[model samples]
Target chain A: MSAPSLFLTVESEGGAVCLRLAGVLDYDTSDELAARADACIEQGPRAGELHLDCEKLRLCDSTGLSALLMIHRRTTARGITLFLDNPPPFMERMLSVTGTRHLFAPESGKARQSCPDEVRETTD
Target chain B: MAPPPGIPVTRTGERQASGVWSTAPHPVLESAAGGVLTEVNPAASRLLRGARPGVRLADAAPAWLARADQDLRDRIVNGSGDTDGGASGWIGARSFEAHPSRSGNGNVVWWLVEDTDRRRAEEALATERERTAFLTEASHVLLSSLNTDRCVSATARLASEYLAEAAVVVSPARGGKLPLAHAVGGQDVVRSLVAADPSQLPGLDEALQGFPPVASRWIDPAALPAWMIPEGYTGTITSVVITPLPGQGVPAGALVLLRSGGQFTENEQIFARLFAARAGAALSAAHLYAEQSAITHTLMQDLLPPRLHRVNGVEFAGGYRPAAAQERVGGDFFDVHHAGSDGDDSSLVVLGDVCGKGLEAAVLTGKIRNTLQALVPMADDHQRMLGLLNGALLNSHHTRFATMVLASVRRTDHVVRLRLTSAGHPVPLVVRADGRVDEVGTHGTLIGALPDIESRTAETVLRPGETCLLYTDGFTEARGGPLGDEMFGEERLKRALSECADMPAEAVVERIQMLAAQWVRGGGHDDMAVVAITAPRTNHLSAVDGHTRGRYTA
Candidate 1:
């Protein structure tokens, strides 16, 4: 009833667009934001520079995880990198256990150094 | 006799100094009684021009040298062990103090200082390593578990590895000969000793029967199978301990550990037993979860609308998503039923949202769903059909209230008479071909909330391209939205309908769902039941559409 409660913000930093997600990301919002991300990459962004800011994002469940997987796949296929910046620990653990840590690869490489067995597949 | 006191920080920094600390050669003071220089560390040796290990404190520095530096004499009179280990007071290289033990039978005094730096670093490293190992094991199990068995076996292996147990066996609590559920290592010299005649394994069946695994001392080595005692594994094996699982009715099963030298301590037995109990419980839960998911899935697939009811002129698209979250099962139903034998006269469209979830909710859903399906064909108006469903819900006290909307769409040429009956359901959003949206506000008290439900019916007209949408609270009260703070009021829904009015029935539902998503974010906060239907514009399309029912989307 109230203009779909979610609001979107896009910020540009050093030639990269940092998409800040301000609300819950589940089944209801998956398609719209996913669509938005897809369009952004289509408009041309370098790999590893297209970052998603989820500092305020409140929830991330299995459905949201699946949606993220979809975006990850779509972005990688186009040679564009997708970064999840400072996601809440809940999402971080979900991604870790699901072995999608490679998607949100920590810049410092701390956890990654502990796990050398991360299987890499060039799958889009 | 009280031991003479001046102690050194450590042997590492030996140099010349006075007062038992030195960076340079200075003076060494003595007690007033004999001018005794009782404490001398290696640094004092430097004052003696490198006095070797056997050099006594008095020999390293004579009292005659102390009169030169009176501060050295004062320290000789005072003895305290509080100085930090590494940092010794830097006087001259004349002396280093003798260090005394902090606890019992204090015998050795040396120039060595305590190393808190190294000790703290080691402890911190150990703590971090422990956490990393735990996370590693958790991730391994979480990502890989596919079925209940794999879940237990994998996690059991992880637990066994974590607990560093000799064995971890997973066995069905139900009938199974192997008392061992899973095993790692034990007295058996063989690797992965599976199928061990069940009788050969120590404390096997005995533990399953509630007795603990026979302690190592109680078990006679001669009694074991010849294969269990291989030549090389003799001493490394400490003892064998068997622990019983907690839950009852488990087929005779227990965890058996093998140690060669020592018997299991009381605490170890308690821990082994407790860990096994939790493992079994978790296993049972995982099994139940898998079973329930399979059944709920199969049942929903088996029953779908056989065909959409055919009335002259309309298009329709409907979607249903069962409460997908593990905690709940939503029982929401919708159907377009026609009582008339001919294609033109009348049809009833019913949609309802049942309260609660799980096997019980599913059962009630099936009952109400089937009962209404049977009752609709006999009813002339929507109200009569709904009253039948309400009676069925009232007959059972298993669940609280359910909201339902029943609509009768009748057409005899241009005028399509729509009679709506509601038992506490969302008012259907009506959209015109001109993109004008309005709420059909056809709502009534929710059924089963109270004994006597006051069902209400409203009449409306469906001209050429006008469509009406019926949906459950799941859509409006999505997780991220303000549903919990306030009801997802009908006003907002009506506005959405008016904004996207000209869309087809399916698109309108999809868009409304999208709008709900936009309002609440991505969460399917509750179970959603949605339907959108347009009165067919032509007799031909209506006739063709009548043969098909609602579609199921993944």
Candidate 2:
């Protein structure tokens, strides 16, 4: 009966679009991330970079991970750089568990990258 | 045009030349006082040329000519009377307007005027009416079925029958390939069309741009792609109109209409679009239905129990039914695990219900099932397995939790040993051969609710012809009774089990499900799950270690 435990917010900063993902990122809420990612890519992302801030993300399930992979596929296909900024420990664990840890660029020190690199790593 | 072979027209033997005869626009046929045809204008000659021209007016003109003749006679009788009475009718395929006038010599001048535009307008109105009726029938047929293939086939058939002689419906398949979902036409025509790539079909790509229907001529068959003209296809197509089919969020497909003769008219194009719209809606519904079924299948994969296989002389059976209101898999889950791969003597079984419903609870159920499977190495140590599972749940960091009954059964030739562990789940029931049911297993706190969880294990031995059952709270919490508010509580379930004591393991599960369904009276209920293990009535083989059943009992 309660509202979904997950929420997402999108903003533009320094010529880059930042997607702040909060709360649980499980099966019920994964589609939101996918839709937002698709919109950002289609509308040119305000810049050449998309930053996913996952500091408040509490959980991620298998379906949620699949959605993330879809977002990654869309971003790279459009030549837009994607950054995983400040992912919580649980998100990191999920990424490794699903063997999709290589899709997102590693966080650089404490500063989030608005536009990182042209060369990104991906796996089949 | 020449006149017909009969009814010769001989100009009246009176004055044949008049100044007005040279320039009159409409045909003028004059008759003498005795009703004999007189002077015939050049226009009149051209108008009546297709029929018997030299005949009497009554024979040459339509039925309205008699009325005109009567008016002419009256005019001749009354000098001051005006007899230019106009009569309109059809001669052959052309419509005509005839006027009768009295001349100074008492002769009648019949002026005939053709109306081609009116005839064209009437024909167009009839075509539109037929098209509207055809479109209505097409919509009804398209909407009758939710099967995607059937809808596509019907759309193609209707398009060919009403819109064109040949038709094809194209939709995007996996990998961005556009496949022809349906094609309707003669064998030769369909073969040529089937050879063509849907994406490369003329006008189809343009229509897929979300524009209106696009009409184009198949300019050159020889210049088309090799696949477009199959070797055995001998027919030729001249015109094609592709109309895009709109879907829920995107274009569902494209409808291609082909003609062997003239180009499609403007009205035909419009009708094709309207027909495509209906076909689009039906296709969209079909796609959504397929998607929903796929999601349900995936959800049921986890919501339903694992394959119930007989293990180590012990038979296991389980059944699950989701709530009627939910078109999804609920939070209930069950699994039966054999301890070791070889001739393992012990097996572990778990049936649990997560705290919430829908996908969230389903995720938690998956986590529980996986954790239990991983802990099978420690199945011999029932308390250790429970403690490890509890720790794993606490570390999951999610709010969801579950209540489960984990039972490990070890079977000998004559008796079966069970180590039952309860995590806030229902107490395991032992059904004896004499139809006596007793509850076993200690009550424990719910799993994943808190850290440092308190769990317990109860040990019991099942003699031959005895059975044990484990279930989730869905069984007892199901509502509907004589009062309509009463829950089918544990007592009722216990009584139901007592009646099934003489049945096999599968029948026991079936009887309980029947009782629960009847208690709910076909009303709403939570997801229910039951797993029962029965020991055979007689042991046909000796026990392991070359020992008989008496050693274990003693």
Candidate 3:
């Protein structure tokens, strides 16, 4: 069977960067996501926030989670707040299961309202 | 006088007699039947060097032309001169075709047409074809093997056979010594490592460093060092061409071509460079492959799972398969470490899966195994051990995490007591002698992801003929089936383990692996690992006779 592919699109608005991740994010595609995140970070200092839109993300394997953690480490080093805009249920469970939800906490109230189920699931 | 029927008479009427015979562009001569020169045209005198009316044909013309005139006269005297006389010979450096016509008085008029240009062109075409064929064959031979030594030898042999009298392929210096493969003519290649300096020759060092070659004329053959020429070569080296064998970024080597005769033409030198390019690429590939394989082999030797055996009276068996079939080791790993000398009777068995796959994951797996090995002294407290491991991971630079299950097994009386704990990993499954399967109640966050980790340890006892199985998520997450996308879920694994209730530890592990492999036939998979801890059934009949089958006396 053909493997699933990952696509990334980056946009800068109001001094903030938003990287949209779609399709599978497993071993084969994790490096690409990490590279894109590095490229976004290399675009000089932004409005202290980097948002990752995961609304269309289909799957995130352990390696994919590791890439997100790496990105988190990079942004934290630069004092940039990172947020997961709209994580799916599986990603939320993965974060909760690994106990890394606090590391990538979404700061915006709109993001929190969009992922209310994710917050409730993590709390449970 | 009418010209011979086969000959073209270009000049007409008044000038036809003398003009056609004298003013012709081709060299013409008239010789008598007695081998004497009767008349010589101006063209003939200019082309033949020494031609006069009284001189003998043999003294004025080349031997082949003179012999052809004598043979024609003999044929005419024998009344059989029906065939036209034609002969080809070289006068000085120029070649010519001699055509003869006989007159009524038996004097033969000879016409010589120069064909030097046509002959040289044919010779050039033949040489070009030969070089093309040699290059095609050289490519095939050079690429036949990915062995560095074999590639070096092939390059030397091909250059000697076609381009020069002898050749030497000198590899990049290693450990202050250069490896050389030398060949002469069609003889076997000889390889040796010599400590000779490359700077002895003007361009040798630069060529070895991947610089463009110096012109062949600039390198004097008298400057060749003793090591540069192959042994037993008797001829004096008249010319040498040193060309760099360029590789991927770095230089692979240098090719030294030696000739005892004339210097190489510009075309020949260009062809030699082309040949070196092909040889360099093949040699570089071979070197790269050797280096990579050596590295992978060394790393795999350390990371591959150990062979499980009976440890501390508890039967232990493990099976592991990497994600890719061609790969040897991946993220999933298992280890059985005998209990430390801390008065603990239990042996620690750890099964874990690091994030990601292939060599990167295997490296992390190695680190985790080493850390756990060092922490075996604290096997009694599972939660404390996990917390320490979590801190170690968090302090390190790697952001990747791992899921793992640790089981401390102790055999007592007729049962095996076990303390099992899971850190964001699949819980251990217990299979009873009555074909009942139960999942241990233990869960926690994965290691390396968070600072503070929480884990609950569950204690259990396995009676005789019961087994406890700890596996990685790769077992339940294997995606395959008739549809090729269905997961081999936990339910399926539990059912498969239920059928192995009274089996030996090795048999149980093998059965689970077989079922999973069948479910994911030829499909992509994550790395899967399983370790089984079984309580051995007492063999009551083993003391009476060694041949009889033992009946469980639990």
Chain A TM-score per model, please list them: 0.75, 0.82, 0.83
lDDT of 2 by residue, A85-108 (tens): 898875775455223466687776
Query: Which model scores highest in DockQ?
Result: 3
Score residue B386 of candidate 3 by CA lDDT.
Answer: 91
- Local accuracy of candidate 3 as per-residue lDDT tens digits, A27-95: 788888898888778774467778888988998999898899889888888888888988898788777
Tens-place lDDT digits, model 3, residues B381-495: 9888898888877844667899999999887766799989989887899999999999998878789866667888898999988999999878888999889999898899999
Q: Where is model 3 more than 4 Å wrong at Cα?
A: A1-4, A9-20, A35-56, A71-124, B1-45, B48-140, B165-184, B190-281, B395-398, B540-554
Candidate 1 lDDT at B422 equals: 66
Q: TM-score of model 3 relative to the true fold? A: 0.74
TM-score, cand. 1 vs. native: 0.50
**Kept native contacts, fraction for each prediction:** 0.00, 0.00, 0.56
Quote the positional error of residue B478 for candidate 1 in Å: 6.1
Candidates ranked, most accurate by DockQ first: 3, 2, 1
Candidate 2 DockQ, CA atoms? 0.02
lDDT of 2 by residue, B440-494 (tens): 9466655664454566789888887788988876678788999876879888998
Error of 2 at B272 (Å): 1.9
lDDT per residue for candidate 1 within B290-316, as digits (tens), equals 877788777766444334423444555
lDDT of each: 0.55, 0.70, 0.84
